[model samples]
Target: MQLEDMTLEELKRLRKDVEKAIETYEARQLSEARAKLEAQAKELGYSLETIAGVSKTGSAKRLPKYRHPDNPTLTWTGRGRKPKWFIDALESGYEKKYLEI
Candidate 1:
């Protein structure tokens, strides 16, 4: 533990180990706190997700950017790969604007 006895490499490695330990401790603390809160919420007839205002769905819902002309139920947020219907419309010479909701 003496600074004078430790080499530069040894000090660097020790720092890395200490940082990893701190990170692990912090993560465990956070998990424990979340579990405690969830247990309390459940006892009160509420879910942790509801109390935290977090959605079961991804972080948050993204509004649909496009809708099917014939079947309005079909929709997409233009995030990932296009859906089959959307590709079909494009292949049928329909412009992307026509799919906008």
Candidate 2:
């Protein structure tokens, strides 16, 4: 259809429909990618659920505690922080450290 023949309202409706279609396509692509990753993990002796658990819990392996480099008083569990540490560091001048490897 010619753009000049379409009314403003009609053009708006068409744009909305296109946007919805694009969103649906993106969601489907994401789902497919996740499924592929899960399949690969399963083949490598890890289930999707197990992988998800590890990701959610940081990792299944043990990690060493990290200390704040600037200030030795603050420490981390090597899994980022439960609460934001940047603000605390700014306020308390506590240095943050993380696992080197």
Who wins the lDDT comparison? 1
Q: Look at candidate 1 and give me any clashing residue pairs.
A: none
lDDT of each structure?
A: 0.71, 0.53
TM-score of 2: 0.34
User: Local error of candidate 2 at 88, Å?
Assistant: 38
**Which lDDT value does model 1 have at 5?**
96
Q: Per-residue lDDT for 1-101 in model 2, tens only?
A: 99889999999888866654543453345446667988999899997667766553544554324433334454455555543544554454333322111
Point out the worst 10-residue segment of candidate 2 by lDDT.
Answer: 92-101
In candidate 2, which residue pairs get closer than 3 Å at backbone N, Cα or C atoms, i.e. clash?
68-95, 71-95
Give TM per candidate: 0.43, 0.34
- Global Cα lDDT for candidate 1: 0.71
Q: Over the stretch 1-101, how does candidate 1's per-residue lDDT look in tens digits?
A: 79889999999888866654543453345446667887999999999778777676876876566766556678888999999998987785556765664
